[model samples]
Target chain A: MSRATELVLADYIVVALYFVLVLAIGTWFGKFTKSTADFFFAGRRFHWWVLAMSCVATLVGSYSFVQYSEVGFKYGFCAMTPYTNEWFVLPLFLFGWFPLMYYHRITSVPEYFHGRFNWQVRFVVTLILLVYLQGYVAVNLLTIGRIMKGVFGMPEVYGAALMALISGIYLHAGGQTSVLATDVFQGLLLLAAGIGVFLLGIAEVGGLAEFWAALPYHHRFPFARFNTPPYLHAVGNFWNDAMTATFAFYFINQGVLMRFLSARSVREGRKAMLFVVVVLMPVAAVAVSGAGWAGRAMVERGILPEDVDAGNIFVAVTGKVCGPGFQGLVLAAVVAALMSTLDTLITAVAAIGVNDVYRPVLPGRSDQHYLTVARIVAIVSAVLGISLIPVFQHYDTIYQALSDFLSTVAPPLAVPLALAMLWPRFHARAAIIAMVLGMILMITALNYPALVTPFAHGVDPSEGYSHMRSLFGLVTSLVIAVAATYLVPAAESAADRLTWFHIPRPRPARRRARHDIWHRRFRVQVVPGTDPRLHLHPETMKELDLQQGDVVYVCDARWWLGGLRSVHAVVGEPDDTLPRDTVRLSEEAVRRGYLKPRHRVILEYEEEPIDV
Target chain B: MGPWLPYVYVYGVGGCVFLASLVAGVRAGAIDLNRPADRRTLLALVAGLLLFATVHAIWIWAASQEPPVSDQAAVALTAETRA
Candidate 1:
């Protein structure tokens, strides 16, 4: 057989074996994924070693291996710049954005979103995730497509379908366990393959020593680009613009957040994130360098056909450098990288649809039923995602398209989420309104870039126009809600905020209207206490029992155990009463949210009032 | 080279069959084709993957590279021209 035919047979055997292995893994590990939480996040008790390895494996997906490698190989010796973008220390947890989702404190991070922002926002956000993750789901298929077509003349759809079959099946069955285990094993395989490429490429192109000596400049520093800015300024406007691309743009990334949220603790999530920072850096550097070296080696050797794209440097290196049987191993390893990411993307969107949207609409369902639906959703998503892969093949890199898509959607949700958690002043109504308006403005702004051209190049100009729109909505919504609150009497009682069913009837004023009337009228009495208007805690002062609409009075203030605690009262209600009337009656107070030490002090009145 | 190759041969046929099977399954109204696993099945899996990587892929890659890029004289002209 000719080389292409030999490669065809070899790739198929390995890919077939790869598929069977993943299926068997799903069969083995699927037993563990028995519940909603397990299906959602691997039961949050995933083994530490498994987590560390999985994280290492996960960072090597379709984009990192394919697009990132392409960039490195084509750029000559300067390919390390992209690796610099990978250096962040997992800021999701440090910023407290994930809360305890990965920490196992909460089952799903979006569950917190539901509590923080209300159900409508939860449904809308889930819709956005499902729409955006489609890019991620498709990119994996394309990565393997490049490998298959470049090496063996296999059609792109063949590779895509093969991926769809293998990953979709096993992921549908095994869920998180299959994903983690397969990722770790595949990660190690890919690493060895990578090292092979490096050694072989360098060996072919004059040894490493000669290669380094021949270069005009032997530059190895990752961050030297920072020292001398490209533009004619102190820090250079270029570096600042790129920082938005690499730094700020990364924080709201969907994939990284999903990975971090899978960890078992705040600290574990931190550990997992930090693991990527440590392991991925050198691996990435070497991989990119290896690709570049291969490009040079192939040209130096003159072995690549004239018809071949330089993007095939990796596949060419693998096919020519490795023996027939072992080419299968490289194929398997790369396919796994593609599969791991594709599976995660598909699984995430499915979980979003099943858990966030479908479950809420139909509140009554068995875990098994939801599991069944999750599998179905995964299958449909895979089909749709696979079909979309070929459409985006023209982009310079798959990740740019993915990133721009995320930049549009993630910014709209990120602002309202941040405000809900951090800003105690944010009301639920304001958050909902802001998010809705933000989504509309963002959709419009992203769809029409020409509208933003005047501000796009300015220093303070928002990086992505969608991000700018979200901020605009956040400000406008806050102002409207705060002003609206003042127009109506502040809800003086927490009961007032409660539903109409919870409101209390007026008590009888005639003490002897009937004998033992209280027993027949009401079973329980709610006592009114002094409202504490001033709460000074490191955390925010949240809504307690008393509202700003009630009659206000200083109930008591004293220093207890070296800490100041005070009780004030809403003495009266809106018979058009002021929030600060001691003479008013019938309002309740409850202390809530954060409290500082020695923060509340009561004033002592010296003499009787004029009414007394 | 043994059953793995012809099985792969059969797999190429089988893959077509599998794609055909997917069509058939779609016709059959089957949403997916996965099943649960047992202890024995799981162990077989771990062993297979280990063997595939350690023996098959590595042996092929390492043995093939033993000759190195030095074997190709055509590369010399391109290398010299670029230099």
Candidate 2:
């Protein structure tokens, strides 16, 4: 067989193994999923590491694989410009935004809006998310399909179909558990393949210094440059674009938020987010950029043919440099990356369809009934997603198109979401207006690029105008929503669960600490007087070293509110009724702290220095 | 005629509106500052603001290193130098 044929055979074997592994995992973990929560959220029992890795896999998709490579080819090191935008958005997401969802027990992002604003807000927000997610899934499928075509000379539709089938089977069998566990497995493969290809390609291109010297200085910089070709324009005016993208991904996107929902606690969600920011994102920046850099270097050196499409650079470089087996791993990695995201989108779409739409329409359905509907919805979503392959395929670069699409649709929803969570006074009517007005303004902006030229630069009259729309809409939405809120009547009890103050927090159970003054259990006696003050015997006070007036915690030995104690005043009263090693408890103190007379309570007193 | 003028005009009005809404929300009890989570979120907001300023400052400096020229201008300059 020829070299190309050999690589194809290797890809087949590797892809086959990948499918089997995914299936085996689904079969193994499928038994554990017993309810809608288990299927949709992995029963909220996922550890930080599982959630972290799964989240990483979801964020770094096949689109990133191809797009980062494409950017690296054109802009050299400046490809990281987009990745660095996440850093600015991370602190808020980790500390503020994600914790709200965790504390609110929100299964979906729109549910928060429902509780905060109204059903209309929830419905509108869900529509926006579903549209964006569908577009997102289509863009990813198109990119992965293109990769399969470029590398193995297969048809794009075949690649799309194969992925749709494999992802659907596993997701249908095991739901979120399968998606998450496989994501961990696939996430590892992604890092290895991404870094591996970069290393091999770097060696092929001579060295790192040689690669830098080959590219222009501007190409190496991460800041804005408007003068480059429309494709290579490293437009650094990222304030609005960054804000929109970062907020939408972490806060608005259900697929991403679902990963956080799977985490055990808000603390775990925070840690998982930190893992993405600190560990995965930095390495991914280098790995994805390396392939394109190598592509640029090799083309300049005449090692490979020039004039390859920018999007094809990643696959082209890896195919030429890596061995057949390594090529298979890269192919599997790309497929894994694609499936990881696809499964999440499919699951999220189904969840929104059932929970927000179907289940709500028909209340009191069995968990199994919803589960069946969820599976059916997943299949329908995948089919619908595959049908959109051609729509994204027409774009010059999938990344630019995806960015523009997200910018247009996501900002309208993100504005209301951010406001609803942070500013509780955000009116439901205002949210409705913002969603409508923002969409109108953004879509209108897209239609009329001439309106934006005075404000921005190099933006084509036809495309790349979404950023301008986002900036305009985000500001306008907040303003309009705030204004409308004042005009409207205030909600009687919106803050009970909607705002930060009203959300329930788990109070720590009281632990019993050693009463150092008396390590052993001292006898407790009831005082005859109804003074309600806990009196200690003068001899007992001397042994326990009680002062004239000191505060001590009287804890009921048995369960009182599951180990709650009450504070009481200690008086050193030499009582004849109270015997040695006996402390007197007033009936009132016993009733107040839920203690019984002679209930063997521990008298905890702060230490006072002995009289020297 | 400066490019920065439009940015300032648009963002300035937008910022004012956002601030107004925030104040209104607080007064209406829509925004509860007393909640622990809300207070923590305020701290995050402060940190995010600092981060945004710092990142943009760095980007502005880097952008200044190379003059703001169009892709056409750069291409024309390359052709001119070759001639």
Candidate 3:
């Protein structure tokens, strides 16, 4: 192993400052996390731009920087394959799955399983998903540890432990709210730091022209050779990364689901998804892979030793191009990548643990009790992640370990979930059989290896047939699902508001009104009742266009919160006894909208089209 | 393999996946072909794929035209080659 590169005092100071800034942001957001909704979904109030940034930060994990850089050095532009090819999965995600999950208010993937199929399906899916998420956390922790070993000479396990502690502390305090807020800051920092390193490296290699000219011609192509090499090839990546892995991330990953659910509306969520795939993802592709490309250019120009380890290329390149303090900034970006992804994963595991595992066994618990358990589960998740670091260390490259894990784990779940959402005929029994049989086939492929050869598509299988495993699993599961659905009687009823075809359409408003027009502020009062009614004084109702049974939106006066503190209620009989400027809301509406008692709120008629 | 092979492979394979999904959606009545909104979505999907293919083709063409170190020469200089 190569000796770690030591840093100067300036570097240490910069890193320390970054850590302090992250913790401070987490603390600030912790104040807003008051309920399970706040902890898991951030009160569903964030704008598309903020969520887009956070999603990019979460997507570009520490493993992305290191592994993509290593591949960028080895194969050049093909490092972008994973990020660029996600568009193929866009149709299913945007049209089919997004609406179903948003309108149904599905909290977790397993929750959807329970709603769509049966408890048995939910139980099976919950176990598989927990394993997938915990394994993801392990991969990320191991990657950051590798970076620490390269830069500071610290042992890998210690580095991972320290990161987990930092992330766990803030996650325990604020949950999803803290994760979203800190990720925005970390996102900007990592992007700026990555681009800065790239530009500086170009200057070091004489100029952009010289750098371009130094690279080998074959490396300039955007795709690798068709299928010659077992590890890095166009065909294998198209199947593994683009087809299977992309589906897993966008469709099934709990962290990504939570990010979408945190959006204020389905439209905002769609905007965030579009921005992530179209705009931010390509930029992130460059940000994560640029260092490796620069490192290769340096090697060609004889600026660095030719035999430098590919795994250490990112650190070596950053050290070569950046000055003392700036190197620390770039290092902090790596840490930022790790922490952003890690915190999201931790929160997701907590959601699944509480919602699927803990809540079912002990139902009807108080909200406070569930909230406390969620925090405890977050801490336990961090500890469990750190413990798995050793298991992932056996792979030659971090990229290999992650790809193997994703390809193996994603298909079984992805196949069933896609069918459950799209195919109305698919029932509970088919789903259960598919998952069980799929997992068994995956395990068989793992031990036998030759079973995957039929699906290899001419790619060599010597490198453990990592990518082909996804194809085998998906095909096997799909076949099983189809056969069982046909063979077994369609006993289960069609899931209402659960499948794609049955998503509730927005009814047209009774009367036309100006869009987003807000009325005067009124003091809010929570009337003692279970009725879904918002009672306003006669004069107040008249001013806001008086109509009984009309839907109205009541929101906090502070518009900057982006409807986080908001609720929708039906207008009731005008209350002549109440004060003219006060609105009376049911206790449930007040709680659902997170409205503060006695606080002034603005009311609007709900006549505009619903944009779901 | 030629430089254009990756593009062909990607679009050929990716196009199948995309089309298959659309068919499934239509069969399930999840995506109605008669609706204007759904039709627009289909058009956008086709356009997006074409846009990626066009941009990648142009990028590779531009990069191919540049005078760079040949693969043979670069491999000769390096002490070890991964591929």
Candidate 4:
């Protein structure tokens, strides 16, 4: 009997419960998503742990389960190459990409482009982002669909459509809040299921000793295995394609960037990235690759048939090892992996579409209008994703296809993005040229590989093409960017705010005594938004002995561990929204001071204030 | 802590992961164990872990079942090895 046919009612119950649980989370969080900020960015209130778990879940999609298993079936422990590559790139991301997004308060990757480069760069990059993310979403859907087809005898297209609809319902209702809230559970589910399957598969295959004995010598060691047909050579592909491309993923991918951006503070963002690198990634590496190793052993032992497709190895092994009750949970976790990634991508695509594309064209629309458009874009993204299923259907394994797609597309954009931040002289014109030229070269290389590599001899010339493709694109992009930067006049002012060197450093405060003539008092009020300045009522400003043009130094009520109390220099914004007794501080200021509302603050202006 | 110890270790690790997730959620204020509203989310999470652990236990039992090797397949394997 087929494994799907053997599924008991208990397994079905578990799967049904998981779906209901995720939907309930979506419905509950929908109440909080009243504004664009709440929906698109989760109101930037995600704690470090939530961000960390969500990043893990988002990074390890259903494709990770299937793709890594497929590679494991073919190459055993070498399946870990892609995941272990994360360690080398994690430190680079922390010091380089993490700060660029966190400090700039960026909402999207393209927004960083718009800030540093020009609208032209932003628009073009957004198009590239849409294609990449949309394709990524579809690949995940195809993976989930294949699993459902194997487990339930469902048609692949229908199953994919159903999953997409399920994801869309939640994403449409609550947006990123629903995505992050559910992601915590989904992340844990993925890890538990991954580990559970590995342990169970090992036991079914007569424990680790017998399992290892069944495999050939080539599949035993992690690093010693040379590249065979239809696989990349470790030396070039490991560093160039795997490490460099994944660095681009962490640095510039919108889904990953959004998680970092959603952290309450840069400190939290850094902590979250550290969690992904130090704790979760190593476990993840083993969890994803173990299934395939077990499958290879079972094949050798005459249990599993040799005819099984490498891509189906994960589900096939799970079906063999897991009983009815356990089968349901494993299946649910697979669905969780798919939903977790698809929801994030759906919202990311919509976010970029609205913020970078639609809103720009239809500027000054009501928030309600944009919010409505954002919802429409989410639906449209899902539909487009479902339409793209046929494209992914042709690939032998999701990992190979994704690597090829990302290696070709990502370098063109990632090169220019890195240059814009690290090289301050990088001009807008140069960024546009680099992106355009790099894309053309990457496409040409992909379409015509023999022109690039004359020594190709494997049955599949494209076997180890990822690193080669990336090398061509990156080198061409850098050459073009450097040439264009020197050739064109630079946009120094635009580049200043975008680079790492220009991050705002808190300056030492000039303190005056409480009895000083410049000292003035106002009650502090908590305000929303991230601006650093203080707002004073026109009447309050008049009472405080201040004018619109006069500069005032505002200090927080109490001091904390980092030395002197909070201080911000501001020209008073006199507003009728405030009563004369109160001075309004942004929410960021409140957090900075660790202050309660209605607390008293001292605003000190020079007795003879200098007018700007 | 006898034969069940291996199972205990498996379920115990699963339990710890569940507890850690809960603690992380509470600390993040994504779930507040104190609030009645957040208590539902906590319950759902606990239920998921329990269901997962229950499944793990079931699989552990099944894996211990010692899958039968067919006689003909064993003969074919022996012949192939000798050849």
Best by lDDT: 3
**Quality class of the docking in candidate 3, CAPRI style:** acceptable
The top-ranked prediction according to TM-score is 3
Give lDDT: candidate 4, residue A492.
52
Instruction: Write down the C-alpha DockQ for each prediction.
Output: 0.01, 0.11, 0.41, 0.02
The docking quality of candidate 2, as DockQ, is: 0.11
Clashing pairs in 3: none
Candidate 1: where is the Cα deviation over 4 Å? A1-15, A76-78, A81-92, A103-109, A142-155, A216-221, A224-264, A293-310, A387-403, A419-421, A427-612, B1-83
Tens-place lDDT digits, model 4, residues A140-199: 788778877877789888889998888888888888878888887888888888899889
DockQ-better candidate, 1 vs 4:
4
Which consecutive 10 residues in model 1 chain B have the weakest lDDT in total?
Answer: B29-38
Model 4 spans with C-alpha error above 4 angstroms? A1-5, A212-215, A224-230, A300-309, A365-369, A387-405, A454-464, A488-494, A506-612, B1-83
The TM-score values for the models, in the order shown, are: 0.58, 0.71, 0.86, 0.70
Q: CA lDDT of A242 in candidate 2?
A: 55
Residue A68 alpha-carbon offset, candidate 3, angstroms = 0.5
| Cα error, candidate 3, residue B50 (Å) | 3.7
Which model is ahead, 3 or 4, in terms of lDDT? 3
Clashes per model (N, Cα, C within 3 A):
20, 5, 0, 0
Q: After superposition on all CA atoms, what RMSD does each candidate show versus the true structure?
A: 23.1, 12.0, 5.2, 13.5
| Per-residue accuracy of model 3 over A314-385 as CA lDDT, tens digit each | 888887888878978887888898899999999999999999999999999998899999999999999998
Can you write out model 1's per-residue Cα lDDT over A506-537, one digit (the tens) per residue? 22222222222222211111236644332221
Consecutive 10-residue window with the lowest summed lDDT within model 3 chain A = A507-516
